[model samples]
Target: DERLGLVQMAIDEHTWLASEAREGETVELLVKSHPHLSIVHFTLNGADDVLRYRKWCWSGPMFRMITMGRCGDTEAVVARACRDGADLDAGHFIMGPQMPDISSSAARSALAREDIAAAALLLHPEVLLWCREHKVWQASTEPLRRDERLKHTNRPSGTPQQPC
Candidate 1:
């Protein structure tokens, strides 16, 4: 009966979230509305419904959401996952390989497409460091370094280049 109860609860939550929740309400608020069920779903079942809803609502994966970066929804989802003790790094690792390689070209391509979020994420300092440390792509560092140098050079003598 307990197991059945959980299943029913999950179904109910899914239905409400899918059909009844307000347009701008975040997944975190919805999940937090039923903490025990959320914990069980996230911890025991990998929060499949949440992931599914992310895909359905955003039309992409978490990484894609991050790349899109239009809405703060992706960040909120990540924060909630971290608060709930989800393996954020694991999600990153799983999604990493599918991402465009951390290179200037990739960043430029994203920019050309007007995907500023994707470009920013690709050229992020941490991502640049990660690529260098992990040898994901040794060449990624050069363009970033060049860009930094250009930033400094372009600044007036008395003005410091703003950090990204």
Candidate 2:
């Protein structure tokens, strides 16, 4: 399976990144060679430009490249990547547990607690949808559920809030 092979290569590259420019070039080459390679999961150092490879998974190509060629636009890229290939149910791959639909409720919650910027780097669908739904850019706030809880608290209206 070329897609599975691509996933393995991404993982291997993350494990051993020698030169900065060279690593970037390597990743770029990967993208070019495998247009369907879309999923990339990884860690990173403080410097944004440096990515500490974790693990990656991808699908083939899609009707359009939702996130291709744009530096710093990982979510679109990943979603587009997932959309690229023929559908592969979770059971289809030998990779670890079914890849979470980054677009689901659970993933969204996890992303909220995570650094928004870092989550954005991963661009998992759950996080992206949450960000979009919340209109996160104008003002940063806790997730909608949290906000709702705060709005409907049963505490005395004028009482100073007690520690939980």
Candidate 3:
């Protein structure tokens, strides 16, 4: 919970920086603050306009963020990608079967990793479809949905807002 709070603060700081400056320093600060989060690296360098940003996200660590289920960050990236008219299906394909050097089993394992349940909530339709086709969807995501619901209902009203 503390880590999530720190991440929310970083997201807030990132938002402020994006409005105040155009340099990479904001992203750098985020990375320095939350180096363990793949989302931080993706957010820093993937702030360009939609097409360029999507291209960068696909090419850089942002793709991992997507798979890792950093929901707020992934949502922001996806929103930008959609705005730029980038095809979500292509991105899904790349992150799924087309990812370099990983076998299907490995990719499936990656998808079913600890954070994957959250990842499923934000995944593109194509990726979700792929998971369903591969029989990995319901088993992995259902329990997470239940847990998320409980967490949401139990959280206090004063909790800091995430940057989704």
Candidate 4:
């Protein structure tokens, strides 16, 4: 029944659209708590709003989707970590609650991974409060947006994430 319950929760979570105020509040919380990372609640609706100062949060620079309720399992938990700032290449380092890589060689590998992630999540409760990000982006014909932040980063400096 636990798995079924999780499925239902995920369904419910995805059904709700995050509102502008809710998204701003989530960004504010993340910025206040995590100075090392950046936060952006990018969405189609806010595209015309100039990414108002409070609407975006970043300490120096860094940045997320998926709601907290859907984070019932480890993969989602780890995805949160990856979205927050924990690099997937960083290895088994704890991101919060812990667990899985299904393609692993052993049968129990997935379970073992899950337990680790779940434990990490429990260890750091704040991660649960971290904003759920729709990490994936949707593209449009809008002129390429520019940001000075990416000068040193791999992504093209002039184009933030839109079509040129």
Candidate 5:
């Protein structure tokens, strides 16, 4: 399996990427060998200076480079916006589980608690217990379960979070 392109990827010189479109089952791509490969994903809508096409819209609000050429008047602006966006990067990807959206009652109950984020790992009791045996989240100060017994005996260190 590959990244669904739900998150757009980056491509540079001599690089390529393929993904399924969000709208329907279709593949959209472009290939070119330019004297100067300044290729990047950009809005090709209303782009007349595009080397080959006047406009390209296989998927509305889509991304992926068409080709490399001089659209410095417009492409330059898009490139600058990309740069500004990068400069505003936060610690989002640094310290968090990168799990996909979980849509269960567990998500709601856990989120209702203010300190749930304090748990390094959020899992059901059985899973959390397994993690403990594997040396995961064994040293957190956040309670793993509402049942204090779940915290006391099975804890690998016999020292679970303080206030269960």
Candidate 6:
């Protein structure tokens, strides 16, 4: 019951924070709850990490929002967070496939008929990959960047290439 209470409280507070734009205060609250805040930017960046954390209740919506470009600071936060071992747990987070929020019964029922392609169209590459890996969507490989070019020359293992 106590655990349930905390979950409820956290959900309530999270909703309030997002709706109210009380970003600073919400971030402070997160920092206070987790010790990693000391060495980490626990506000926005950690929020992405949180999205990538399966243990967190906000993962699904948050990940979806971030991937959909619906969140305010998701890009900046995620970029900054990567400098500090974000990838270390990134795979773990995606592998588990967190459950979507279903507290709103209507939404839960609606999801029964939801289309995976539509959902995938709204997600980031990482989230798209996660969804595909989990069988929520059929995987389609993203095209390589046109500017992403490489150059090489034929050479033997024991010799460097001569001038062309």
lDDT of 1 by residue, 1-164 (tens): 12222223335535553321222234467577876663211111112333434432332223222222223244545555556555545433121112223445676455445455775686654443333343332333333344343432322222221211
Q: Estimate each model's TM-score.
A: 0.19, 0.17, 0.20, 0.19, 0.16, 0.18
Which candidate tops lDDT?
3
Residue pairs with clashing backbones, model 6 = none
Clash pairs, candidate 2, are 61-84, 62-84, 67-77, 102-126, 103-126
lDDT of 3 by residue, 30-143 (tens): 777988985333322222222333453344324322332232344555566567565556543122121223233443454556445544554444454444444442344232
Report the Cα lDDT for residue 115, model 1.
57
- Give the Cα error of residue 47 in candidate 3, in Å: 14
RMSD in Å for candidate 3, one decimal? 14.7
Worst 10 residues of 6 by lDDT: 149-158
Q: CA shift at 130, candidate 6, in angstroms?
A: 38
Q: 1-164 in candidate 4: lDDT tens per residue?
A: 12222223334445663332222466787889998995564332121121232212221222322112212344544454456664434322322322222221221232234343543343222221121111011122221122321222232122123311
List, residue by residue over 13-126, the lDDT tens digit for candidate 5. 224644333422222232244535543333322222331332222212233332223333345433443444522123111111223333233433443353345322444444
Off by over 4 Å in 3: 1-20, 41-164
Can you give the lDDT of residue 32 in candidate 5?
49
lDDT of 2 by residue, 1-164 (tens): 11222233335446663333222445567778988877442222111111122112322221111111223434433344255552334322112222323333333444556546645655544435444454433233345454553443333232221211
TM-score of 2: 0.17
RMSD to native for every prediction?
A: 19.4, 19.3, 14.7, 18.8, 19.4, 20.5
Report how far off residue 93 is in candidate 6 (Å): 4.9
Q: Ten-residue segment with the worst summed lDDT in candidate 2?
A: 46-55
- List per-prediction Cα lDDT, in the order shown: 0.37, 0.35, 0.39, 0.31, 0.32, 0.33
Q: Using lDDT as the measure, what is the rank order of every candidate, best first?
A: 3, 1, 2, 6, 5, 4
lDDT of 6 at 1: 16
